[model samples]
Target: MHRRRRTAVVVTSALLLSVPLLAACGNEARPGAAAVVGGERIEVGAVQSKVKAVRVAQERSPQAEQLVKDSGQLTRAKLYDLIVARVVEKAAEDAGVSVTRKEVQTGRAQLVGQAGGEEQLAAMYLQQRGIAPGQLEDVVRRDVLVGKLAEAIGATNGQEGQQKLNAAFSAAAATLDIDVNPRFGTWSDQDLALGEYKAPWITQVTQSQGAPVSGA
Candidate 1:
């Protein structure tokens, strides 16, 4: 139980913040940083592109209405999530955590079996989660990496190595000098996650964050 909490805080939430010692990345005043993890710039444009691809995939699929309906929330959260994903990558590298392509393939197969088959897994990811089939494998690979990281940090079936792992994650995030554009939200020290903050006018009414490309 404690191990799960620790790993969830350190690696599982992957972006989920935990542990009380995280110092919010103080790079807000720095411009052009959609997010900066360990001083590496994750340009706003990169986030925008990823969102574009997701939107494109959504538009082409039959789930257009739900995709459009959740665009605002999805775009924002997914952007933040990707930024956190970068942070996770750096932390994993530092901890020597890794996964092979075969591992990812095997994991996906196992998940497919649990869901009854590939078609079913695709439905859950696409229809339910709004993630495209093309991106499903990427999602599975990330989970595999997160699990390896947890294992490396000592989050096993039953163990007490979470605090140390949390410390490591905090150190990595802090040192990376993370900063988010104010247009998105503030970085939360408590949750070790990005908290969305939008302009009053924008928040006054719910609206689409971005529209599908004219041709796309």
Candidate 2:
């Protein structure tokens, strides 16, 4: 019985030692990075900066409390957005697609018009997409890229076409060799997702002119 008790203590000690060692190894592997995509580090600091921007914008809004409550996972969401941006860029490059600054400006202008003004557009984006007013340009640029990518790949305006677009993004994501910090979550190259966050759907190129073509 004494021998069995000694063995149990030894086993328990081993288990306890392993936990910190594993954590240390994880931190060492991706130190300071929220994720690494295609050998490029998405720094944790960058994610925090984005979250800060959104928080500042949310605070200025009348629905500040609700906005904060809704975006409890703001850090992860921002990181996910950064990852998706790289994924979209990769897919666009693979398809010989690109978005000009002028295109982004035009797209933003159209969205502002649709939303009825700058403030309304900002509010709409903040409420629906968790984007800060300052960050809206980047999001619009990504949308333009997705639209052009859809066009370049011959993806149509239907479920079948959406699937095809998704496959393209998934392929791009796989090639990136994305390695996310385990604290945030796992990266799914197959689903183009970060943990519980499923990849955003691709908007049809045909619909880009009617409204803001959104994707993560």
Candidate 1, residue 211: how far the Cα is off, in Å: 36
Evaluated at residue 167, the lDDT of candidate 2 is: 92
Query: In model 1, where do residues sit more than 4 Å from their true spots?
Result: 1-32, 127-130, 157-167, 196-216
Q: State the lDDT of candidate 2 residue by residue for 1-216, as single tens digits.
A: 111111100000000010111121145777777778999998878888888899999999999999887777777678777887888899989998897898778777877887889999999888877889988888877776776777667665567767888899899999999988887768787766666655343444343234443322
Question: In candidate 2, what residue range of length 10 has the lowest lDDT sum?
Answer: 8-17
Estimate, for each residue in 33-133, the C-alpha lDDT of model 1 and write its tens digit. Answer: 56666667766666666666667877876767776665555545555656556656777899898878987786676667767777777766655444557
lDDT of 1 at 117: 79
TM-score of 2: 0.83
Error (Å) of candidate 1 at residue 213 is 31
Candidate 2: regions farther than 4 A off: 1-25, 199-209, 213-216
CA lDDT, candidate 1, residue 94: 92
